[model samples]
Target: MTVNYEKLRRRFYLRLDAVFSVEELNKLRFEYLSSKSGLVRGALAALIQQGVEAEQLSMWTGLLKECNLALARRLEFIRERESNEKLTAEAVDVSYPARPFKVGLKHPLVRVIEDTRKILTSLGLEHVDGPEVEDEYHVFDALNTPAHHPSRQMQDSFYLSEVGKLLRTHTSSVQIRAMEEREPPFYIFSLGKVYRNDWDATHTPMFHQVEVLCVDVDINMSHMRYCVGFFLENLFGCAKMRMRPSYFPFTEPSAEIDIRRQDGKWLEVMGCGMVHPNVLQNVGISPDKYRGFAFGAGLERLAVLRYDIHDLRSLYSNDLRWKVS
Candidate 1:
C-alpha cells in the first residue's frame, strides 16, 4: 500500500494553523504522532511490515521524521508566544506614585515607664516583672495589706471570677513575688500595667507603675529619699522636692514626694519609705536581720506632668493627634 505523504503534510499544517491553545496543540500531536493509532507513525510502520521496496520505505520514513520535527518546532513557538502574552497581561507600572503609609509613635505612658526603668537600672537596681493576673496572697496579703483595706474591695479593685484571684492593682505585687523567690539583700525595680476601678482626668482603670525595692541591713529612709530625689532631679530637672507624710500598707513612715514645678506649684509624684517589718516577715525574711525600702510611682501621673498632657484618658483614647516627647 502506498502512503499519501503530501496529503498527510497538508492535514498536519491545517490542524497546526487552527490550534489557538497549548491544549489543542497537544491533542493534534496525539492524533498524528502517537505510536498506537498515529497517522504518520502507524502508516510508516505498516509500510515496513508490508515489505515495501527499500527506496519507498526510505521516502516514507524521511517524510514522517520531517513531520515530527515540524510538530516539535511549532510546540516551541506556541509556548514562547503564550509566555509573552502572560507577561504583557501581568506587567506592573513602576511610574505610579507609592502609597502613603502612616507611622506611629510610642504612648506617653510607655515612654515614662521605659525612662524610669533606665534611670532605676542605672542606679544599680535590676529589672524584674511579674504576672498581671495574680492571687490575693501576692497582690495584697503578702504586701501586708490589711484584710479590711479598701483596695481589696470589688468597687475599688478588679476581682476575677475565681475566688481570691484578681488582676494586680499595682506592680508592687512584682516586688512581693521577687522577695518570695529570692533571699534579699537584692535591689530590684519592676514596671508593668495595673488595674483599678477608677477613671477620670487624673485616674484610669488601667495604668502603668514603676516600683523599686532595696533590701539589706540598715537600708533606711535616707537611702530611699536620696534615690527618689536623684530620680526626680534627673527626670524633672533639679526641682526642689519635699516629702509629705503619707501611709501605705507595705511601707513604714511612707511619704508622698512632691516637686516644685516651674510654675512654683508642688506636684505630688511618688510614694516611698522603709519596708514595713510585717511585709518583710510575710515574705520569710527576718526584720531584725534585714531592713529595706520600697517606692512606687504611677507612670501616667509622671507622663502627664512631663508631657503636660491635660487628661490621663487621652493617653488611651487612640487619638493620633496627641503628640508627646
Candidate 2:
C-alpha cells in the first residue's frame, strides 16, 4: 500500500500542535516554514491546504502567522545572544598581570640556574660571567682547541663576522677568561647563555651552560672526581653515578658523567676532567704549579633529564601552560 505524502504532512502538523504548547508549536512551525528547502515548503503548503479542505482555514491561518512572527523574534534573540557573547569574550583580558603586579616569579630555567648558583656558592665557588660575544682566541685557542681543530668548523661554531669573531660556544671559555684575570686557589662557577649553530628537538641555537672550575696547588684527579660526585648527588638527590672516558680538547683524561635515571638507565649529564696543562699554560698559569678540574654541561639537558621534559624547545617557548615555579 502506498502512503499519501500530503496526508502524512498534514498529520505531522496536527500531531505537533497536539504535543506542544501553543508557543512551542508556533516556534517549531516558524522554523519549518522559514526553512528554504523545497521539502519543508511543500510540507507546509500541503498542511495548510489540508487544513482548508478540512474546514479549519481560520485556525490554520492564525497558527501560520503566529509561527512566522515567533521565528523573527527567535532570530533576534539568537543575534542578541551572539552579540553579547562576542562582546564579553572581547572584553576578557588574558595577559600576564600588570606591574606592581607582585611581579611573578622567575622562569623555571632561571630558577634552576639561581638555585644551582646558590648551591655552588654554598660549596665555596664564586660566580662569574663573561661576554656572550667573544673573540676566536678566548673561545677556541686559549682553551687548547687550536685554530686547526675540527671542532672549530663552521658547522659547529657560530661565526658572527667576516673576520670570524663569534658567540662563545661554551661556558668553559668563561673559565679561561677568569683564569687570565684572577688568582686561583679559588673555586669559580660560571653560568650564562651560549650559542651554537644547531637547532632540533634536543638542541637550540641558543641555550645556557654552567661550569665549575676549581684551581689550587693540591687539587688532583681525586678532588675533581669527589667534587663532581658530590655536586651530582646534591643536585639530583641521588648517590649513584658513573663516569665514562670521554674526549674534550681542553681537559686531560676527560670523562662524561652519567647518572642513573628513575627508569634504571644511565644518562650522560656532563663532561669533566683535569684541566689540560696546555690550556692552563695558554692562560699564563703554570700547569706544574696549578692543577684544577673543569666540568660543563647544558642546563637544559639537566632540566630535561631531571624533569622528564621531552622537548628542549619547550623550555624557551614561553608557553604559560608549561610554566612552573
For all candidates, the clash counts are 0, 0
* 1-325: candidate 1 lDDT, tens digit per residue: 4437778878888888887777888888889889998888888898889988999888878877887787788888888999999999998888988789766678777777777887897899999999999999999998889899988988999999999899999998899889999997899999889999998999999988889999998788889888998898878777599999999989887898999988899989889988999999999999999999988889999999988889888988877665533
When superposed on Cα atoms, how far off is each prediction in RMSD?
11.2, 9.5
Q: Relative to the true structure, how large is the alpha-carbon lDDT of every model?
A: 0.88, 0.78
Q: Candidate 2's residue-wise lDDT over 1-325, tens digit each?
A: 0144445446545645453244665555545565554334555576675654544444444545655565566556656767888899888466956557344655667766777787788888899998998888888888888778876899988887658688899988888889999887779989999998899999999998999999999888888788888777877788899889989999998999999988999999999998999998998888889999989888888878767789989988888755434
Q: For candidate 1, give the lDDT of residue 225.
A: 83
Query: What TM-score would each prediction reach against the true structure?
Result: 0.68, 0.68
Q: Residue 191 of model 2: what lDDT? A: 95
